[model samples]
Target: MDVDYVEYEDYTPDNESDNNITTELPFGSSQPSLSHVLVAINILISVIGLGGNSLVIWICLWKMKRTVITTWYLSVAVSDFLFCAFLPLEVFYMMTSHWPFGLVLCKVTSSALFLNMYSYVFLLVLISVDRCVMISFPVWSHNHRTVGKALGVVVLVWVLSALLTLPSLIFRQTTVRGSVTQCYTSYMGPSKHKAVVLTRFICGFLIPFLVIVFCSSVLCVKLRRLTIKSTKPYKVMAALILSFFICWVPYHSFVLSESDLKNHSVEVLETGLKVGTTLAAANSFISPVLYVFIGNDFKKILKRSLTSRIEEAMAEDFRTVGLNHSKSKSMEIVKS
Candidate 1:
């Protein structure tokens, strides 16, 4: 999402004046009904995301053993949980179109949004690559993959994501426009704005998406070659990757298109962006739901506790992969 601002024409600060700056809102305030609808949807997303991600965090941290898979799941859950935690501020801003939170909270909230964006996608990429490596070189992966190394990688992802989010912190500011106060990004010029948008589209969406697709493709080919009969693990992974692509592509597309102001109507673009962002936000909770449904049998999930079902799903996927690898290895030994 772009900086948190209200719907209004762009303004530029005077060279000699310190107070004026250009701004735009995440959603338009022209339609009070739309704002209300957005507020309702965002509140719902926040509630579901908070509950779902919290459950995943608790299950991953306490119920499951500390393994690479669990580490990735825990890290992703934490990222989503933090994002959902900060959503109320956005909900407030959207409902009132007034930012009384001051500049620091403004920056923090915006930064958290992107932090969740980058960290979540990067973690997904890591998971996909890890799965591929596990399939391709089971012995090496078994020996080299460790919870400690996974933690290091997760920390690195967070650090890189934070670095990418600095622009949001640097540009976000709170300013009073008459009776209303707005928090928005003041990029000062089109060049700077274009650069930020392009960076987000490329790093936050394009590259990570390509990598995930490649890894998924490779995994599919490898699994077919191995003649693996159980498709549950693949199904779960496919649902995750597909859901991410569905949720994020619209947001990125609308944002990237907004960069070219002449080609698109401002109102249309803004509306599209709001809708896209809602879809993107939906991704945070969707992962946990996917874990429940795609990861396990529905009947069994109904009988088991939520945590037990999730744990079983995680362990079941890992066990399936190991079993497939063992079978392949045994076949090779027999041939030898």
Candidate 2:
């Protein structure tokens, strides 16, 4: 369940027959070179992603007033925040090549990682649909877009994500071999393992990917027909979708390739898996950059601290008076 690339060592228990073989790793030589590099990458990701995602959650959920898009983003931030929370354990596992936290943590951390990924993609789909609705039927969206409904959908997505993560939890285990501790998914058979990977690729990646693409296409057509000048919102959505695709597609593709897991050598698969996982993990931190660049208000709010935003909120009357003075001056100039 931990983010790991394990090379299992086969052993047969003294009390067991030859047929009762077990796959385990002995406390032998550690892969210090690879472990050091992976540990460094994870530490970097944890520090940046945890901070960026926390800021996003704070801004969208608390600092800014709730809107449909903000509510959707709030869900994403929550998932990323939870994902970041477990990074220390992953880092520890990578550095030492052992699972010290025991079996339950192994299952929970693995399940949480996949759960967050699924939840993230599902939220993106919802955001795309919301945008498509806004563009295609502005009147209906104006009347029907409610925070309560958006929150309800968020709750449903969480439920779905948890359900999807259950298989990983069920399959995950902690195996010890000669003082070496390992956390891994010990599928009953290769068939079962392949099935799980296929399921994840389809449910967690393919379906949501298709939905986002379809929504984007429809939204583009509607905007083109309407002759809209402001495409900032669409641009923001596109950035989000593109980032998600870039970050996740490689991971999913590598996973799907694992259906033929026997063909891959341990060293080769480990390297590829590590690279894919690093890319996938990058999404948590990169998203905040996209938000700042593509979201109109995100940069403005981030530029100022919480106290500054509160002060601005308190000085609403002063800002309104200034705006009125500017308007009056412009009117007089026009008349002259």
Candidate 3:
């Protein structure tokens, strides 16, 4: 899977003759109503994601002091914002089933999706590890953690994500079949397809998921040892992890199923994929919402202006995990 608007109707070598036959609409044209609904949802996601992530980026860049946490949030916001920014192109293609944009844009837009996927997951992993290190080894974190180092990590993430996304840029092409111009990935063979899908699953989801889980477990154990009363941090961390898992697992699962197409129906897989992709797209916007609601006090969230709430959320003391009274006081002094 390319994760584009098109329904991936794979054909074996036996029927490769019919590969270019663009009979169905990009997303199940059999039912016009369902396609319209998906289009509407995608449009909504694009609007909210772009607006919310832009606000986060602005705050991180201008309204707050640059800390390691701010650097991480800013990088994640930029990645999500870029993904949302290109969603209109996808929406346009979905509605008209046309690829008027040249080949360069076709490659760029398709690759942007995977770039966001890889960068977002990699940043989450960094955040998890940073938090774990902070709690588990506060003195070292206080001594060594810096915004410059975080920026270096962010650059590494972008480089790695772009390298992983090269397949989309190379394999994606626009083709004219009859009257419709379709933008799709052309894998060389089943082995190549399997390799891409497996790489995406392992790198994009599985390994990062394991790392996050381990970090979360460590944080939970360390937090239990502390006397902190606030559950806000707990809620925020859980929401981030759960939302990423819920929104992405379906997409990855359906993509993985593409390898064993003999056991599944094409129509069902197509529908599942469309739904999964939408859910995954939704994760881009959900992070900003989480920052606003879960990162702040419920009463204050309602009373505060949006900008103030977001600023406060980003600048919140959620990062501090007090180990003991004396050490906590000393850490606060060191932070100051």
Candidate 4:
């Protein structure tokens, strides 16, 4: 029941044997170099993404009046912003190229990533369900979808996501392979590592992914069957769902099925994982563009912002011209 990558490709383990292995990624030869590159991108994404998602949260909570629709979007904005904020610590590991942060942070940071990613997924599912409910029972939904209840749901989602991600916290370890250090979950023993990884893949990506797809499909069908043409909100919702599918499906796909379970050759899997990781960050940007930027109020604010800048520039230009004219007249008098 050896759980080595070479063994995972061909051997089948008994139930007891499956749980015997570890997930702590062994450090690699190029650990420091890889960490530097990953750290740079992680920090860059966190800074830019944190600012953008903050604007989203600001617009939803303070600028735009909150309705049930806006409430759901605001919830999603907060989730994305939270992910962006804590993401810098992930780069901390990358900066050191080793998880010098120790067992506690290794567990916390990776667990937080899983929590945020799943929290976002479940929120999207909630939004789809809320839309369906509104369409089917607008009056009832209006009576019940209060801000307090929305807050409660968000709290529950985070709690549940954190619980699901707790194992990473519990088992997260910094491992060394030769000189390279990597932050990842470690199994208790070698015999069960592959099994643990496979299970994690299913739980982390597959089940919730299937749920999202099913719920979204049902939602689209319900909307399409309506007796009237879809309105602006529905169109926007559709666009948001489409963006979610495009941006995230490949990421999960790349994660769950990227490599053979027992193959020690993580080179291919790691390469694919990096691509998915980058794509996942991109999703933090797309949702706001699809949902917020297209709003009438958003457009008006953008236009006003642009206008203000233009006005300031014109005033500065006038002042410059006046100064030049005055200086020229003085020179002419002096010459005469």
Candidate 5:
């Protein structure tokens, strides 16, 4: 869609603050209930995620640097955590019913939001390939997939992901076309209306999502074909793919539903949209928790960190969020 250039945060571009900040986009209005719910959920997730992702970084980078995979996952955790840092602003927006962080913050926050989203998704794809390669071509991968090399690939991904999300930042500007302030993506001057429509969907959501889906599918297939000898690897990969689909299917579906402009049945769209968006955001916080906590003995250690009650073992995961579990994990990897 041709994103309407509307100012959302009560800041006009001409007030000298907007100098060059863009914080507007197409056809989005405030939904108080949805925003409130999203903000609360986002804040809760962000607050906890900061700790979890930080733990992941500490473990993978400083405690367990023996494998190349650790480096890749550590980067994913950091990126996802950084994304979580901006969740509070989104929470504020939800609570206030509008963007209150001004134009520059809107741009910076939204840019980080998208960069983190796409960066992690793409990183997951890379992880899939790395796993597939390790299975299908172990010697080649071992000889080539050192931490340094993996770090380089991850760096490239960050650069590429950031570049791809640049347009989202570029097109966002808060401009007061009328009395109401709005945060929206503003397409400059006259341009092909249909082009922006297709571009927005195809480029913004569809292509990136499809990229993850396609790569994940192929990687899964490759893993399956290579691992019929044992079902465990296949099961793990299948779980990963299932997780990705569960988290992302609704997200892409919402984009598809919103594909058509002038489909002013926005209330329906917003209702449907918020559900999927929150679900996807929930996945952001849930991924590391499920992957790392379940994949390891963190729960047991955390339970020891707590009072060591039988009830506590059953409720072990709660301690990762500072619920007072006793068994703690320590990684002694790199300091710098």
Candidate 6:
């Protein structure tokens, strides 16, 4: 999804000055009640996302012994939790249409949001590739897919995400308009804005999306010949990929429409854009549901207690890692 059209701040690709940053829809517009609705939606999203992702982070980091998959899940949960942390500020901005937060904080919040977004998406791509590797070359994956290697990849993703988000931190400024202050990205010129948007679309969305789709498709086909035990993880991963698309495609579509052409007078597209923002924010919470609670094993354990579920997830992680270790040793012995 284009971060430019994100709900919190106005996205005016026009060569506007730092002081004239757009915040809300036009004055006396028909959607006076829209702000109230957005506040409610964002509040709900914040509550759910914060609660769910916090729990996932705790379980993955403390309860489970580290594994490649657990490490990825931990990074994702941390990112989502941090992202949702800023939603209240968004809610406040929506209600009052003012940014009490200064320039530094504005950049911080915006950068954090995008940082997590790219990190989460890339992590999903990594998971897809990991699953594909495990399915395609089980022995090779067993030997190579260590927790250390996974952490290195995650660190690299964080660095890349941070670099990508540098533009938001640099360009986003807090400008005072009349009595109200608004925080927004201040593009230097038309060409620069276009370049940033195009780069973000390709690097942040399109490339990671394609990688995930291709890897998931191949893993799905390979799952047909695998045992049920091996198949379950791949199935869960496929569901995760599907849920990501369901959540993000609307947002990116709105971004594409807004970026490439003039805004149409059609009210439906306008309404769809707002709905797309809400859904995109909601994705932070939806991930935990799809990745954790969707499985029957998790649900059954969760019924007993949160602790039980954590224990069950941890056991599963260790069990999988232990099996891979044993398999790798056995293969080495056989080859020797």
The number of clashing residue pairs in model 4 is 14
lDDT of 2 by residue, 288-323 (tens): 777888877888777655545455454554557676
Query: Where does candidate 6 have its weakest 10-residue lDDT segment?
Result: 1-10
Task: Please say which candidate is ahead in lDDT: 4 or 6.
Answer: 6
User: In candidate 1, which residue ranges exceed 4 Å CA deviation?
Assistant: 1-9, 12-21, 297-336
Whichever of 5 and 6 has more lDDT, that candidate is: 6
lDDT of 1: 0.77
Give the lDDT of residue 286 in candidate 5: 65
Tell how far residue 331 is off in model 5, in angstroms: 16
RMSD of 6: 9.8
**What is the per-residue lDDT of model 1 for residues 215-265, given as tens digits with 9 covering 90 to 100?**
989998898889666777668677877888898898878777877767888
- Backbone collisions counted per model: 1, 0, 0, 14, 31, 0
User: Candidate 2's error at 75, in angstroms?
Assistant: 0.6
Question: In model 1, which range of ten residues has the least summed lDDT?
Answer: 12-21
Could you tell me which residue pairs clash in candidate 2? none
lDDT per residue (tens digit) for residues 1-336 in model 6:
222233212345234535334333421134658746766877988999999888777667755667898888888888889889987876676667677889888888767657876888888899989988988999999989899999999999999998998888887777676787776665655455667667767887889888987886787688777766545566666776676677777866765665443554434555666677677778788767865656554444344455454555555566676756645544444343
TM-score for each predicted model, relative to the true structure: 0.84, 0.83, 0.83, 0.70, 0.70, 0.80
Candidate 6 residue pairs that clash: none
Candidate 6 stretches with Cα past 4 Å from truth are: 1-30, 266-270, 296-336
Task: List model 3 lDDT by residue over 50-164, tens digit each.
Answer: 9989877776675566889778878988999999998899888878878798889899988877898999999889989998999989999999999889899899999999999
- Give the residue spans of candidate 3 off by over 4 A: 1-25, 229-231, 297-336
Top candidate, metric TM-score: 1
Better of 5 and 6 by TM-score: 6
In what order do the candidates fall by TM-score, top score first?
1, 3, 2, 6, 4, 5
Computed on alpha carbons, the lDDT of every model, listed in order, comes to 0.77, 0.74, 0.77, 0.59, 0.58, 0.69
lDDT string, candidate 5, 1-336, tens digits: 111122222223443353233233232355555555655677778888888877667656645635666666677778878777876776655554366568887677767656766676667667767776776687998788887788888999899877767766776656453554445654342232234335544654566566656665766677556535454433444454466557657655655555452453555655566666666666556656765545443344444434344444544565666755332321111111
| 211 Cα displacement, candidate 6 (Å) | 1.4
